[model samples]
Target: MSLVSYTKALNRALGDALAADEAVCVFGEDVGAGLAGMTLGLQSRFGAQRVVDTPLSEQAFTSVGIGAALAGRRPVIELQIPSLLYLVFEQLANQAHKFSLMTGGQARVSLTVVVPGSGSRAGWAGQHSDQPYSLFAHVGIKTVVPATPSDAYGLLTSAIADDDPVVLFAPAAALGVREDVTAPLGPVPLGSARIRRPGRDVTVVAVGHLVHDALWAAQELAGEVDVEVLDPRTLYPFDFPALARSLRRTGRLVVLDDANRSCGFAAEVLASAVEAVPLLAPPRRVTRPDGTVLPFALDLDRALQPGRDQLLDAIRSVMA
Candidate 1:
């Protein structure tokens, strides 16, 4: 079994997708230079026609991608930074995400938008480090945040293959994660939750990079508190059934999210959990303060993002 890093897995996924489907193509700024690591060597392998590097205009290229998708091409748009998504929010939320429904399900925008380094990336400051998956999920777009190397590979494949538009965020913190690949990698269905650690005391639902923090907390609290860590790979079409089953067994819940606390993905998960199942105690979530803008200072940047200590505290609170 060979060890595959998260970034490498993403690169492999794009390569495989390009090789497997003639309709699949990519558009982004500096993608041909492989700045994000996922598109490394893709241009030479797939040729410039398939891996076309567009001008530095997110909105323009995003619109072009939508047009290409409508014209029967599967376009994967790679955003160097997550916050650039704000620039093309109208294109994604209003236009591309609506075409399928606007055309009475006759039209589909098979477009995949991949954000390689989402969330705080060591003083990228406010402009570059925003994890806005919740916003996309709220707008009814398929949102994916894979937590591991294998999930990164599988979920990206599925997102590209999906007929509807999908936004996959590869959290910056998770980029370093590497796993031993014993079996062949393939598509992991969207909206599925993976139980990283099974326990009976409480279920800790962690999103994106926070999944790793939850797992670490679970390991540290072993024997004292059985914390079941669940990674909601896709936030929009969430695996509510899996959460309900976990909550039934644990009777308690804790959510670790990297985005803002108010009306974030964690809030949605907590809201849905309470309505769907009976809980032994009130659920809790650990997230950045409302409308958090990460500071440029290294320490402050790290402080703003949710970490293992916060997750551990939340888990203990639920267990109490």
Candidate 2:
């Protein structure tokens, strides 16, 4: 078995895709230099044409990706910062995402929008530190958040191969996670939920990087309660059936997400679990305060984000 960091795993996936398929290409700012490390060495191996570096126009390049995808080419657009999604929302959500349906299945946009560093990065503050997966999910765009190195590789492969537009968020908090792999890396199907830890008392639904916090919280509370950790790798077209099954076994739920409390991913999970499944008690969700804007100060920034302590408390409250 070999150990690999999450960032390297992403780079490996991009390299593998470029080599495996002639139709696959990548475009972004500084892609030639691979400033994010995820696209490192890609330009050298794939050549400048396939590994393109666009001008500082996100809106223009984002639409260019959509156009390329519509022309039967699989284009992966890399956004160094997550907030850039907001700038090109119309291009992605309206243009790329709606092409297939709008044209009555005449077109399939195989475009993948990759955000390397999503969520808070200590002092990144308000603009650069937005976890906007929920926004994409709400608009019915395929959204994925892979927690481990293996999943990062597998999910990106699947995203590139998908017929519809897909958004892959590599949370900044999870970039450091490393894993040991004995098997050859492969695609992990979209809309699948993996059970990180099995238990019978309460099931904790964690999104993006919060999966680690959920697992740690589960272990910390192991003696007092049996906690199950469920990582819904794909947030949109969510694996609700799997979550429903877990809720059936645990009879309780607690969601840990990085997005804001109001209309966030956690709220959707909590609402769906309650409405579609039987719950022994009210569900709990640990997330940023409603309509939160992360502050510039270190302590104030940390205060705006969810943590293990908050997740543990929520689980305890739900279980009580």
Query: What TM-score number comes out for model 1?
Result: 0.99
Model 1 C-alpha lDDT versus the unseen true structure: 0.93
Using lDDT, give the best candidate's number.
2
Candidate 2 structure quality by residue, lDDT tens digits, 233-272: 9999899999999999999999998998899999899888
Off by over 4 Å in 2: none
TM-scores vs. true structure, each candidate: 0.99, 0.99
Report the lDDT of model 1 for residue 144: 95
lDDT of each: 0.93, 0.93
RMSD of 2: 0.7
RMSD of each: 0.8, 0.7
lDDT of 1 by residue, 1-320 (tens): 99999999999999999999999999999889898899999999999999999998999999999999999999999998998999999999999999999999888999999999999988689998899999999999999999999999999999999999999999999999999999999999998989999999999999877888888888899989988999989998999999999999999999889999899998998999999899999999999989899999999888887888878787777777
